[model samples]
Target: MPATGEKVAALGHRYAILLSTFIGLLLISNIVAVKLISAGPLIVDGGVFLFPLVYIVGDVLAEVYGWKASRRAIITGFLLSALASLTIWVVQLSPAAPGWENQDAFEAVLGFVPRIVLASLTAFFVGQLVNAWVLVRLRERTSGRFLRTRLIGSTLIGQLVDTVVFCTIAFYGEISGWDFIGYVALGYAIKCLAEVVLLPVTTRVIARVRAAEAAAIL
Candidate 1:
């Protein structure tokens, strides 16, 4: 429970929440992405469900908090993701307690895959920063008009980069041919579609966050 006026580092209370939300979602997405699932005809990772929301919150951060703040959050997420992978790897190496039979299950679920981690970290860092930068630049150029254009456009470009980086590093050798291409194509399209579909909700969240930040400042 955050007490009234509680603050974390330089970010004020209200803004800190957004940063925390972004990092939390990023970490969870990576962990759950191991399972491949079928959503109608589209086959995707478990992360696909939660990961798009990562971008929605990211949009809020960029649109409401500005580039410097958004960049700080992005860097934080990247570093913490590496730390998580390291921690998981170390845990896997540690000798299990005698008679602990769940080690296999634990490893199966949470084992640290270096390639996947590298790909996720690289893609997230690049994708999110690109998302933030594009939004901020568009905001500046348009003087903040056309909110839908900014959100969806940035997501299109950012998701594209993210999908490419992640698929290449994580699955390039493991999955070849059209499977690789479809993996990238489907993930990218779904991510972009999520942004476009949720534009209204995203815009409202941004507005509300902006208002809250303004109120907190007073």
Candidate 2:
């Protein structure tokens, strides 16, 4: 009982909010990703567009806290994503009553594609961990110099891996070969650029959070 209590306390202190945010982001992104959309000439795929923010949040957690915290976030995100997919699949497969003509369409939209599911969850888990790890290491290596560089560079690296893995997994055969690669590359670039441009604001928010945490510690 004591050990269990201690473990719970530790988890609550170390990662309650980060885990919550990660799960929230992952679940919501999966739901939104069911429908693809467009902004201008860019074809913004569902879930992919909103999912970038998870990387940013992962960065914040890692930069201010540490890799372990970020890792916890990643794991939590992965598990929740899987759970969400399972829920969708279960709900989609269950029988629908008469007068429900849209049931088939609903299932069609929400049904899980095995390859895409594996690819998405795998890519995000691995990519987010890599992003957090790189950012933390770079910060230490540079002695905290070039904050923007670390933030942007880490995100770019992570997003590239994520895009390739997800696109290849989800759309490789369904899309024309050339279009598949092009869309993945374009999506990665756009997401990375957005993160880079948001660096200053991210830095400010991180600094504030760290200060608050430090004050509490002291």
RMSD of each: 3.8, 3.9
Model 2, span 1-218: residue lDDT tens: 23465555654564577567767877888777768787888778677655777777788899888888788778877887898889888888888888788886887788778887898898888788888989999999999888888998899888888888887887888887778878887988888887877777788978876776665454
Clashing pairs in 2: 33-46, 33-47
Q: For residues 1-218, could you state the per-residue lDDT of candidate 1 as single tens digits?
A: 44344333324766778889988988898889889898788788889778999999999989988999989999998999899999999999999999998899989999888888889989999999999999999999999999998898899999999999999998899999998998899888888988788888999998887776665555
Candidate 2, residue 39: the lDDT equals 82
Q: Please report how far candidate 2 places residue 13 from its true position, in Å.
A: 6.0
Candidate 2 wrongly placed segments (more than 4 Å)? 1-15, 97-101
All candidates' TM-scores?
0.91, 0.87
Task: Count clashing residue pairs per candidate.
Answer: 0, 2
